[model samples]
Target: MNWLTNWIPKIRSTKSSSIPENLWHKCNKCGEMIFKQQIEDNLLVCTICDHHERMTAKQRLCAFFGSEKCFVVEEPKKYSDDPINFTDKISYKSRLKKYREICDSDDCFLIGIGSVEGKKVVALSMNFKFIGGSMGRALGNAIVYAADLAVENGIPLIIFSSSGGARMQEGMFSLVQMARTTIAIKQVKEAGLPYISVLCDPTTGGVQASFAMLGTITLAEPDALIGFAGKRVIQQTIRVELPDDFQSADFQFNNGFIDKIVHRSKMRSEIIRILDILD
Candidate 1:
């Protein structure tokens, strides 16, 4: 076990200084090398291409609410672990343990009660790093509870959606979340509170079909992928070719699926402005 963990550092060491591999980041869009600190300062957007990189749920919370104001809202109820006893290459339980450790979250969804620019809000964000932000029973339960909390407190709700879709491991139980989350958002809407959704990159599949698209005001990061089906699959199914930028956020906004395409730099102020209007 010690050998498995210790071999890499020894292999990469140099005579003068250890290589700082994590000190720099390469922009996925522009292929530009940027300092990790610079990326952090820019809220993880690529400085050159202005590409909005996926951020952890905690990072999203920090960006919106800052450390002092944000308080995590506990899930109202815990869901069963390995409800399906699913296993592929590895057990679903093992996968959960791995992602829980990596993302520092019990599930992909992070729900928090916080004030954004002095207005109290319930913020729900997805961490794509955890199982591609897959919507499972825990996440479904979290969203429903968060919606209830927002309604109970008379506060608005905002969800930052960055997901690859439903968790296949949970089978039909995962697909059912599409309805559960949709109904949850409706509860918030019925309370006459604003429900805003910020669609991040790769917001697709069951999530896009559900609460992610049910926002009162739908906003997306520039150039993010916003679609239900993959381009290749759609083209194949329809037996026709698709536009090069068919599923891009800009394309979706032009086609009216999104209300606005916001840049990462102005996201905080834009959200605050909207909250102020609805306040």
Candidate 2:
């Protein structure tokens, strides 16, 4: 047995590298190993299973704007970094700093002006990588900025929502954004500019309750999660087991919560067509 154990080490050493690390991503839904470049070309969707992967705000913007440069709108000023002086395992200020460095973004909200298929539009997207895309005062202000920009320019506005909820560190101030953003969207509506909302995966919590659902036409990626609460929480509260597809974009579309469930491949063309028609 000792000799066999010694020989096992030698045998293992003879094998090739087992680490599946470089330029390949395993699909979370379908468990398919796909090349990174292929996934990027496919808009981060799995080729075999057609699973839509989560995208960063920057990636989503680039996809919509194509290879050309899109002018980014200046985000509104943020409140104090640690409004409540919030602290848990780590301080809120420190966490913000860390996440900013990790995500390479000032905040979760990214506002910009970009041409989509030659139609100029005002755009805002949530960066879920930054603290789960929690909506704070900065994001709320950004939404207002985008809305005002659209209203002022008489251009269409599009928002990509991929948030977990309101920023807990900001407390009530964060929750206040829900109302603020809704009001801003209402202003855009009153101005007669189209406000399109694209809900990405895991659009839930305070975000779903507000602007994420207030689009002139609500569209979601295929199989993306869209709900106010988690399945477990809802089931526990309602005292019933949830459906297999509960909170999914398909489920939402079937139930009329979502206007359409667009696949990533068709998203750009669809948006362009809709913009043309609306224009």
The clash count for each model shown is 0, 1
Query: Which residue window of length 10 is worst by lDDT in model 1?
Result: 12-21
Instruction: Identify the leading candidate in terms of TM-score.
Output: 1
Off by over 4 Å in 1: 1-21
Error of 1 at 44 (Å): 0.3
TM-score of each candidate structure, all chains considered together: 0.92, 0.90
lDDT of 1 by residue, 1-279 (tens): 699678877675662376565889999889999999999999999988888888998888888887734666656688878988999999999999999898888999888897766798899989999999999999899899999989999999999999999999999999999999999999999999999999999899999999999998999998899999899999999999898999999899989999999988888899999988888
The window of 10 residues in a row where model 2 has the poorest summed lDDT is 14-23
Off by over 4 Å in 2: 1-21
